[model samples]
Each structure stands twice: as structure tokens, then as C-alpha cells.
Target: MQAYKQSLKHETFSYLPQMTPEQVRRQIAYALAQGWNPAVEHTERGTPAKESYWYMWKLPMFGEQSVDAVLAEIEACHREFPNHMVRFVAYDNYAQSQGLTFVVYR
Candidate 1:
């Protein structure tokens, strides 16, 4: 008989390099132009949960057309969870699914 064990480490995969504020804003702008709504999430650094299962800090909401609002939320998340990993998620309302996801902080 063969046995297999699944690992639950959050660091199993290397994500894209951490992004800067300008880069994040640019990405958000592009997503918004494409009719995607921005969202944010974060997870504790040493948690056993997979990255995909991280807790959401904010949910996607439409009618947010200002880049400053998105940037402010990103900055707020960074301040509130300095030792955790933070991410940006864009949801496509028309497609009814996530359009893009990126890590903005490590």
C-alpha cells in the first residue's frame, strides 16, 4: 500500500515579488478600467492555512471609481497587519468571478 500526506504550509509556493505602491495603483487602475472591483486580504505570517484560504479583509464592491480609495485601503491594510502577508483581489462582476489577484506585501 502507498500512503501520501498533504502538507499545509503557506510558504509552499513563491509568489511574485512584492509590489510597490505605484505598481499596485497601476494594476488597480487597469482592473477598474476593465470593470473589475478591488478587494483586499491578509494572513498571519506563520499560519498553517494555505495562501488561497487567507482571511479576507475587504470584499469587492462596485461604484468605487477613485484610485485614491483603493490606495487608501491598501495602506490601511498594511498598517493594520504589518507582520502579515497582504494581497489585492479584483472581481469581475460581469463574469461573476475573480479576475486578478496579486500580493502587495510580504
Candidate 2:
């Protein structure tokens, strides 16, 4: 029998259907409504888990109230790092932890 091999993709939401732009907008709205700070990050394609720390696109967008603003940043990151995997992360200050995270570009 041939050996089974797992796919290298281990990013969050990788198994789910790729999110449409509208879905992503909704998710960003939800995070904003919850008062979570949005942040953009990017990692090189096929980056190993041992070097999983993605580079931040910029400072976390604290007090951001518009979903479009967050989406714009994601797009900017994608434009700058067209070949990298871009991700969206929401930080919950009340809980002092990450609340939502998903790859937005790959």
C-alpha cells in the first residue's frame, strides 16, 4: 500500500470553503462590534511551524470602528506581499487574548 501523507496546509480555516469577500466583511464587522482590535499579519509561503511567527503588517488597529478600514489594510498587506499568506487576527483586550484568526490570503 502507498503511504498516506497529510497536506502541508495547517492554517486556520484551511479545511473550510474559502471565504467570499462578503463573508470576510461580515466577520470583520462582528469582531469590531465585539470591540476587538484587528491586526494584519503575513508569512512566507510554506513557512514551517518552527518559524510560525508571522510578520505584523503594522500596529494593531486599536479603536477601529469601520470594517472597511480593516479590509483595506488586509488588501494593502496582500498588495505588498503578493506571494505571502496574509491573515486577520482579532485581539480581545477584555480577555487579554486572541478572539478570532483566519488566513485571508494565500
Best by TM-score: 2
- Output the TM-score of candidate 2: 0.88
Candidate 2 local lDDT, 1-106, one digit each (tens): 7542233454567667889999999889989999999999998876376337789999999999999999999999999999888899999999999999888986
What local lDDT does model 2 show for residue 70?
Answer: 96
Q: Give the TM-score of candidate 1.
A: 0.76
Candidate 1: minimum summed lDDT over ten consecutive residues — where? 5-14
Misplaced by over 4 Å in model 1 are 1-16, 47-50
Off by more than 4 A, model 2: 1-8
Model 2 clash pairs are: none
Please report how far candidate 1 places residue 88 from its true position, in Å.
Answer: 0.6
User: lDDT by residue for model 1 over 28-96, one digit each (tens)?
Assistant: 898889888888888876534454477888676566888888878878988998987877788888999
